[model samples]
Target: MRRGRAKSIPKSQTRRPAEAAGEVARLRQELQEARALLRELAEGGGSVVAKRLASLEEERQIARGQAVEAAMAKSKAEGELRRLQAAIDKAPGFQGWLLRRARRRLETG
Candidate 1:
C-alpha cells in the first residue's frame, strides 16, 4: 500500500492556554443561556395547555347544563302530549274523528 501524507492541524487547535480558557468560559455562558431559554419555553407551553384544559372543562359544564334543560323540556312536552291524546281517545264519535284527522295532518306536516 502507498503511504498517505500527514494531516495538517488548524491554528485554532493549537490555541494558547489563556485563549482556550476564555473560549471555554464563553461556551459555558452560552450553555446557561440556552438552558434558561428552554426552561422558559417549557413553562410557557405548560401554562398554555393548562389554560386550554380549563376552557374545555368550562365548555363541557355548559353543554351538560344545556342538555339537562333540553331533557326537562322534552319530558314536559311528552307529558302534555299524553294528556291530550287521552282526551281525544275519550271523545264521543265525530268530534274524536275530526281531532284524529287534525292530529294526523299536523304530524305529517
Candidate 2:
C-alpha cells in the first residue's frame, strides 16, 4: 500500500474546459427558469405561488449557509491532520528505531 501523501495533479491538467463550460451553462439555464417561474406567478397574482417561492428562497439560503459552514469545518480538520502527521514524522522513523533497539539488545547479550 502507498504510504503518506500522493502528489496532486495540476488544475489545468485535471479540469476539462468543456465540462466547466457545460456546468456554467446548466446553472444559467436553471437561474433563467427560476426567474421565469417567478414572473409567471406575479402575472397570475397567485398569492400561494408567491408565498411558496419566498419559503423556498429562504430554505435555499439556509442550506447554502450550512454548506459553507461544513466546508470550513472540513478544511480545519484537514489542516489538523496534516499538523499531526508532520509531528509524527519528526519523532523518528519507526524501522530505524526498531533496528537500533535490536542492536542494543545484541550488544548487551
Off by over 4 Å in 1: 1-43, 104-109
Model 1 lDDT-worst window of ten? 40-49
lDDT of each: 0.91, 0.83
* Predictions: Cα RMSD each: 15.8, 20.8
lDDT of 1: 0.91
Clashes of each: 0, 0
- The deviation in Å at residue 14 for candidate 1 is 55
Kindly list the per-residue Cα lDDT of model 2 for residues 1-109, writing each as its tens digit: 9899999998777758899899899999999999998888788858767898999999999999999999999999999978855554455688656655665687699
